[model samples]
Target: MPIPSTLIGIPASPGRAGGRVVRVAEPPGEPATGPAPADPAGEAARIEPAVELVSTRLTARAATVSGDAREVLEATVTMVGDPALLQNAQELVTERGRPAARAVWEAANGFAATLSSMGGYMAERARDISDVRDRIVAELLGLPAPGVADLDAPAVLVATDLAPADTAGLKPGVALALVTEQGGPTSHTAILARSLGIPAVVGCAGASTLTDGSAVIVDGATGEVGEVATLDEAVEAAAAAAVVTDWDGVGRTADGHVVPLLANVGDGPGAAKGAADGAEGVGLFRTELAFLSAAEEPSESRQREAYVAVLSAFAGKPVTARTLDAGADKPLPFLSLDGEPNPALGVRGLRIARDGSGGDGAGVLDRQLAGLAAAAKETGAELKVMAPMVATAEEARWFVERCRTHGIGRAGVMIEVPAAVLTADEIMREVDFVSVGTNDLAQYLFAADRQSGPLAALNDPWQPALLRLIGMLGEASERTGCPVGVCGEAAADPALASVLVGLGVASLSTGPGARAAVGAAIGGLTLAQCRERAAVARAAADPIDARRAVAALDG
Candidate 1:
């Protein structure tokens, strides 16, 4: 037999493993034509039960996990139960005389298309809609729902890409690692894999062509996959990776330059995990947790309790909390825009309040800041608050004023918009600090959809243009004396972590599972070496050459 050529991909979660491949089967295709129901109402009624079953199943799955995984599953459950989806399905069944399964398929595709057209985070939601649509349609057809089949033994799970529910349900003991032909660093597959401490390589060129049960090696750090001589050898490699190592509660390069290693957390449990994993503090406390399940704005006290849970966990360590980042992909029932042609570019993040929509969305930010202030007082924690999607210096000043009104001493803005990077010096002068959200930044910079597999290269952190933007922010931070941090999927990559530090980022914030590896990667090198590599990476013409040039620097 011929040896399989090594496949290159993006390193999502850092670790190394090897195993026999267990390919996840594709979802059920378009359902066959079925006999029309006797009545349109009856056909439409069938949609509810199917949706309920899928929702119940998803809810159960969510119960077994917490933090980001739980949030992803719960969001999917909400998608399953969306009334708009029901109405769309009903209209198709009643007006078009379609069967329940076909109605659901058509309705879901239409909605997914709308989301895809919006790009950025919205495109990712489109994939989730398709996953839920498949499960619900399968229920109506009396067929088993699509997902990773239950693993009877330890193996590498290979797929085109995993859905949120599919990735959330994976167990580390049985699912050795994940390798997907499609998906980018900021994809749900990458985020969930890091949370689970599973090695993952996404966007592998030839991953889907490997046969089921073939022995292969998956190096998540290097994004390499190739055939191994035997399954025994693969098992040995995986077993070797199982040995545990602990992280000392300090983050610095070999030459003694301090780089704060913080954690991106969603809730109390996630905060605790991050702290336990030696996170200096919470770099990004995603405030969306309080909003995701709420039908309306949560009370100040309710929001305070949730904030207190995380702030108290970190204690004296600084916890940077971001206000509600809803709309676009994460539309809230109470705080959603009406019929925006492109919600991704519309009233999302800071604009949700600043856009002057009929609702007092600005009040939403005010109340949130008030709740965070209350929580900070109650917990006696070092609370640093920030707003997302601030593109201009004026917007940065507006957010800072809101933070000041709430008596929050520290305030910042997330550098997700390209304009934020371009005018970073001006914006930084208006705030205390800034953290770059490389995921959204990459999408907007390249004008490529973040969730599109084929466009993953453009969204990749290795892109010179993306690094140049971060460099611009770093330069601004230097001039303004405003600390810069990265709390994005890019920070989770061990190699990129080094480059980001070289680019003058003050802190690197990532998933708890990634801290040790990122710390170790930086621990071996002096800041000078990191800076040299960053310069080398920036000089490369493309993502591929950038990665290769950086790798060659070790020699």
Candidate 2:
């Protein structure tokens, strides 16, 4: 009999294994019989050891990982051990008269809720803290920690949810493909798995229904996971599948034309990892990562450390660091943010920087300019700072003036807003370079929320309108003598990379896995051929036509 095969979705991660299933079910609910802690002093004494233990575990784990993985873990540990969080717990226990455990749980939950509601970077940090708190609480109660998956043997890991820390602990050699019942494509697990070159599937319902010891196979390329009757068949499939590598260089067209391959980095570790993976340089180093994880606004020194780390990691290679782009979608708690009915359209990106009054006290523009200037002076790194969500020439001019006032010599703006694409010529004249953020560009062009399931169709980067936008930006770059690049999903896409290069995008920055494939593609074409192909792509009315045009050119 053939092995029963079932398809399921899960967040992607690295490695492949075959072992008996080890389901980590949620712990049974314990009754709330005990009264709340009557005193803050008593609660502090009770919770201190547990917090210390969590800190120790986190520290030990942080020491084991490399690159951004280490930074994120260490940051999480710091947040977990924060005095404010502990004091808040103590206060809750004293005021509510709840049990020590209950007080800590409620306080942590409240904090997490506050962070989540705050949105943007703070919310992401809040979620991290909540995860840590759950693990700490489990340790205190002697319960199996949530998100912990044991990898004592070779096996495919199945989980309802896997936190970043738990995912980091996964031994690539022992663990096979990861299948999860929940998580999105952009989730940390998915991003890490892609980084580690692991096969994973996410968002699969009823994944837990599969029996232990059932044979399985996962196809990361196609996002498929299923049970197999025979282990031999599974192994054969795994063996036959090609592993993706991150060897960087320049991308090429089918006819052989060079296209620089770069990496999108958010922090120092990310830059280091990208460099190690052979990224030509940092394509998009989001400066906001440093500020998001902290409870307080990051000082200039703190900002400098982050900027220097990234620049040093690249060893003097060019790093296009985007200035603070935080706003409604990515709320900063330290920044005073007024609630907006439509955050995507509201004050964000270059608008926030220009206005300087979008609730975060001092304008984001001032802080970003100061940070970039300080980082440049400290590291002497070849820094190219850009603004996000810029839609007009005037915004670009204001941004350039601010950068110059702070002594930043190189400045640019991202063309993500549709208005920017339409007015690229005017905008390009005010900056040193331009990079299209096609993800947001596509969403805004189609009037769709890229994050919404109902708007999936509109989120396609290959949509005709988005391609036209790229063409328009390219035309502006030509007219203004500004070097344009693309640091968006479309840039990393092997299928679309050639088209972007052909459209006069001077550089294409993407995730590591795409480097070689793109290099191979671009290596096959000449610059003129790419230009012609890009012209054809611009004229195409639909995705199918665009793909067909490129395919015909290759053939």
Most lDDT-accurate candidate: 1
- Give the per-residue Cα lDDT of candidate 2 at 140: 60
Candidate 2 contains a number of clashing pairs equal to 36
lDDT of 1 by residue, 1-555 (tens): 111437988878877788899999777889765677779888889999889999999999999987788878988998999999999998889988899999999999999998888765667789899999999988998887787988889989999878989999888868888999989877899989987889998999888788898998788776778778899887676566553544466788989999999999889888888888789998999998799778888999999999998999988889999988887567788875776777777778888888867277988889899999999998888999999988999999999998998899999999998988888889988999999888889989988778778887788888999999898888888889999999988898778889999999999999877788788888878999999988988888987788778878866
* CA-lDDT, candidates in order: 0.86, 0.69
TM-score of 1: 0.92
Model 1 weakest lDDT span, ten residues long:
240-249
- Model 2 residue 290 lDDT? 80
TM-score of each: 0.92, 0.78
The lDDT of model 1 is 0.86
RMSD of each: 2.8, 5.2
Mark the regions of model 2 whose C-alpha exceeds 4 Å error after superposition: 1-5, 8-45, 91-94, 243-248, 267-270, 289-306, 312-316, 327-346, 356-381, 404-410, 438-484, 488-506, 511-555
